[model samples]
Target: MSLFVDSSSIRNFLRRDWERAESQLGSVLSDTMVKLGAVLNELANILDGDSAAKYLPLVGDLRKVKRFINAILLMQIEKTNLGRTDFDKRDLINLMLLHLNYPGLFRRIRNLFAVEPA
Candidate 1:
């Protein structure tokens, strides 16, 4: 018997995967916010000295980055849930790439969330 893959089945599989990814991305955003809050609390405890001076500006910059990330994540989640066939996927991919490639921003974020070595 000849075998053929149904087109609708492929579409359904892709849709499910996309939904799963969207959910995971939302979870990641939530986790990132929590981590940022923790970092903010730590920074707040250091009210003076060189560390505070250095971190104060970094935290400001990080806040701006966080806002940008929140917007991107919200846009992606909305687009994915809406299943807008006309939406250009490339735009979402480009935004993700831009965030990843943004000089020092990604590293700073990572450091904020990093677990210190014992």
Candidate 2:
């Protein structure tokens, strides 16, 4: 589904998406920013990893970022510290931040596993 074809294209894609992710200000729900699709896609893409909750694109809400970080980053990476990860959702009061990963990871995964590109 991505447009990446080679090293050059991969760099271009990362630069473009990474810039877009950086320029973004994590303003909570500015109309369509809080939708399920937006949240899920952003998570799936792992955009702006390591950004604080209030700085991620559509995940600035301190009330809805826990599940993703817990399920994706904290769980996927097997962190030893259980409750001290990003997206500080202390006492059922917060949720935010994307997982840590470079933008080029997508292309690398595709290159390693994709088959029969049409």
Candidate 3:
């Protein structure tokens, strides 16, 4: 006799499998820190007054954002050294969503990274 699995059961199984896969991928904190570092570096390259003027209105004050990013990076480093995994996953997710929704900003960041230093 063959046992039939219901749709809900299959969905639950798939969800659990996905969670397991995510867990095996390692800490989300580290991934977010790396992404933030890339963004920060791109920002640093474009932070001169004239270059930052256009972006400031879209992203708020560039200086404040820079400080915030640095703080997050430092906190992540400390947590890692302490063997801690706790972090605000929502903040990282929201930051990613913000980037995704703002194509212009994302393009600017991508362009900055693409340019070769003279």
Candidate 4:
């Protein structure tokens, strides 16, 4: 019947749309992972054989950026329902979210955003 055919066509279109969206999200996630890895590497460099105490401030800044990166990845993973496969259990954002979901956890994470790098 024509009605059945139309319904099938609609389903196919929706499936294609969903696939496209998923593909785009995967690309974004991949990009974010690369950026996060770079930031982590920089942090390692700062921690390695620090000759000056001033480097401590820079280390803190790199850490904050890392947190921001994790937050973004966590949000995307949650939206795409890909957290389990995309991120490990020790993921910073995952831990942060876990704490955030609890009551009165804002005091901890809120200060993180308030901090400004020198």
Compose the digit string of candidate 2's lDDT tens values, residues 15-109. Answer: 34433543385533333322322334444344334433333433333223334433333333332333475542231122222222232664565
Candidate with maximal TM-score: 3
C-alpha RMSD of candidate 2? 16.5
lDDT of 3 at 36: 50
The true-versus-predicted C-alpha distance at residue 96 of model 4, in Å, is 22
lDDT of 3 by residue, 22-113 (tens): 35866545565455544444444443335454444433433445344545555564334322445444334334435645768867877878
- Could you arrange the candidates by TM-score from highest to lowest? 3, 4, 1, 2
- 1-118 in candidate 1: lDDT tens per residue? 3123333332332334333544676665555444333332333344233454443333234334344345555544532432346644334433443454564775776678999989
TM-score of every model versus the real structure: 0.23, 0.20, 0.28, 0.26
Which of candidates 1 and 4 is the stronger one according to TM-score? 4
Q: Candidates' lDDT values, in order?
A: 0.42, 0.36, 0.45, 0.43
Model 1 segments beyond 4 Å from truth? 1-37, 47-49, 61-118
Candidate 2 lDDT trough over 10 residues, lowest sum = 91-100
Candidate 2 deviant stretches above 4 angstroms: 1-55, 73-75, 79-113, 116-118
As a TM-score, model 2 comes out at 0.20
Pull out the clashing pairs in model 4: none
Please report how far candidate 4 places residue 66 from its true position, in Å: 4.8
Q: What lDDT tens digits, residue by residue, belong to model 4 across residues 1-118?
A: 3322232233343224333544576755565554444433433443444432433332234234334445555655334433446654335433543453443665666676796878
Off by over 4 Å in 3: 1-28, 62-118
TM-score of 3: 0.28
